[model samples]
Target: MKKNKNLLEVPNINSSDAQLKKIIYKVEDNIFNRFFNSFSKSEYLCVCSGGTTSSCARDNFITLDLRKEYDHIHLEKEKNLIKIGGGVIMKDLMNFLGSQNKIFPTGLSKLPGAGYLLTGGISPLSRRYGLAIDNIETIKGYLGNGTFISLEKNNLSSDQKLLWEGFKGAAPFLAIITEIGLKTFQAHPIQIIEGFINDNELSKIINLAEGFPENLSLQWIYAQDIYIYILAEIRNDLDKEITKKYLNKLENFSSLKIKTYENYNQINFFPKELDLFELNKNNHSEVISLLGEDLKERIQIFIKCMKEIIRSKPNNSCYVASQQLGGKTKEIDPKSSFFIHRKSTWKPWIYASWKKDDLKEKEIVLNWMNESWEKLKIFFPKIHLAQIHNHLNSHEEEVYLSFEERLSELKTLKNICDPESILPPL
Candidate 1:
């Protein structure tokens, strides 16, 4: 086995390189085939993306780092499709699309890779275009059993169709996706209003946001303070007037800052403070994302719970945030994807962080995250498996919540695709 120490550097600190023994940097056809067939069945194998969000690696695990090998971007203008390697990051993809005057549904942070799409990507414009998975036209990858498969949305046999559905929301647990083809959209003007809000304004904002148009969406983060962002796609004069009326309602907030961009990629919703916190080399963090219904009646109680949780946070890095997801997202066919929470209006995620290798701090932060999730479960019951946590005690619980009814079908498909359990446990 080829052991390249430099290949071990992933974004998340939870899976330290010190714990890994084998990392294959070569992903070419013949080399990868040889490595895959020869690797021991007992060994834990994970395909690491360029923008890894968590430490999916563990002690003695083997990783296929696609960062260098799979970094190509091929755009088919005639077909309005963008094909990218698994290692391609959101920022790079957006830049390329912007240069061509095209757009895609990318999340606020531009660091994530294909894992974002495989997890059912949620973008500010998702209210209009639907989840990222809904736009994926093609997928090519290798199942855990060393089988290569190329699947397309319009062209698939019955078995290939079933596998395609499995890959949509449960890909990390089934295959190593090497290339993905996503349907692109025409670039349009984007309007953004971002600012801080008091505890009282949060409820009002959410209430008003319920009636937001398909092109408009709300996102807010609660750490030491509450920050809110309203994004709208300005397609015409009507859109501008609608967005203006919504902004006028929030004029009571003195800190609101409004800006217009040519495309969604130009807008960055994350606060600078949080960005700086993420830049801290000593920080190690984990996030659990949960889905919920509209908090119309439980707004106050939800705020109170968040306040209590924040008060007990281990550090400044731990916080709870949510994004709206009820417009076009809910209009998709229920049987199409693994994201089954069609009635979900919000996706709230708890972020916990501490200094790297501080075992005491890690334990405390993890406890805080777990407790926060439990408390929020009263309002937000479903889980969004954005990142698989094989190391956590709640891994099974998260899996149960994420796949729900389709889980049995998924299990059957898993048996056929990954009978040896080479991928993360389902």
Candidate 2:
């Protein structure tokens, strides 16, 4: 296959574990081992299927492409578990699971790799099944030091347990995940309710979300024109009656545009392609806000701040979006993984884009996003790691916030497994 010029190319690894180890030894001896003495000589990146939303998969690094080596998806019907390679995309996995009448909470976007799970994947089905990271059973990966490790949650040593915890929501910094085993659930029919709602109905939307059943998920996107595009997913017919009963309340405020799907394929979840602009590598600005107890009040502030940012946007493509995160996602034990934003009911984020060659426009958008974030952050202090890439803001601080109380432990794991800092810095 012809490689994309925008991406880094590496030799394909199509061999057994023994041969793979020899390749790793050779590569380490020739390149990675040298990083210990000269950290600035060359940067290294682990690109798994190239689905990263960030520019971390650029040509500047010595990229280790895992797509060719690990792109298999195996379903074990007896065990009710599915083993997915790091290279597998959301669409491929969803299709395979849907074929077997099974499902796993994963992101709606089709491009993101299993790396999405490492950042606390919030899916349309998450309200019932919990975050993707919560379903993980085993992780097999190579550390920055070229050591291959396989860990199971059911059986772990003290040190292994710590590393596992760090890997759950912060895997990029810890290792290159080759494959993972996750628990699966039975697939169910879905009902999609979508429409444009005026700003006045924002509070009613929040009220509906507060009482949402576990089988329902809500997503609201604030467009550049100030209209709120609301999309909701109802899991199955079992909850269809109650779901419609609550949705009926939305009709009082929103103009309805409802649709239904028997399975995942019928629903359109892919993002629209922007032809004129691209994500600004140096100036891309984004911030995730975790809504507190005052949902309605905080959402009002969020909408106002987003409107201000949108009005002053350097480009017409920039907008704000949010995902509901309160049902089964909130029930997961905070201590189980590094992702600790479970108490949050909503995750609102700001995104800024610019013309490919317009440096001035990039700067303006970045400044506006940052300034707007500062004004709105008072209402929601916590952050989600998935949407907040390293280049967007204070990289280290964002990593610190994602890990929060477990920062020290994660750092210690980094020291032990990646002593040379061969991998990209968080």
RMSD of model 2 against the true structure: 5.6
Could you tell me the lDDT of residue 415 within candidate 1? 91
- List lDDT for all candidates, in order: 0.84, 0.66
Write model 1 residue lDDT over 1-426, tens digit each, in one string.
226564366666665434566766555556445555666766557777754566456667777777688889999999999999988889899999989988999887787888888899988889999989999999998887778889999999977887888888999878889899999999889988888788888888888888899989999988888888899998889988988898888788778888889987677668565452344557888889999888987888988898899899988778888898988999998689888887888999998999887889999999999999999999999999998887789899999999999999999988988887878878
lDDT of 2 at 131: 88
Clashing pairs in 2: none
Tell me, by TM-score, which candidate is best: 1
For model 1, the superposed segments whose C-alpha errors exceed 4 Å read: 1-7, 16-18, 27-42, 271-279
Worst 10-residue lDDT window, candidate 1: 271-280
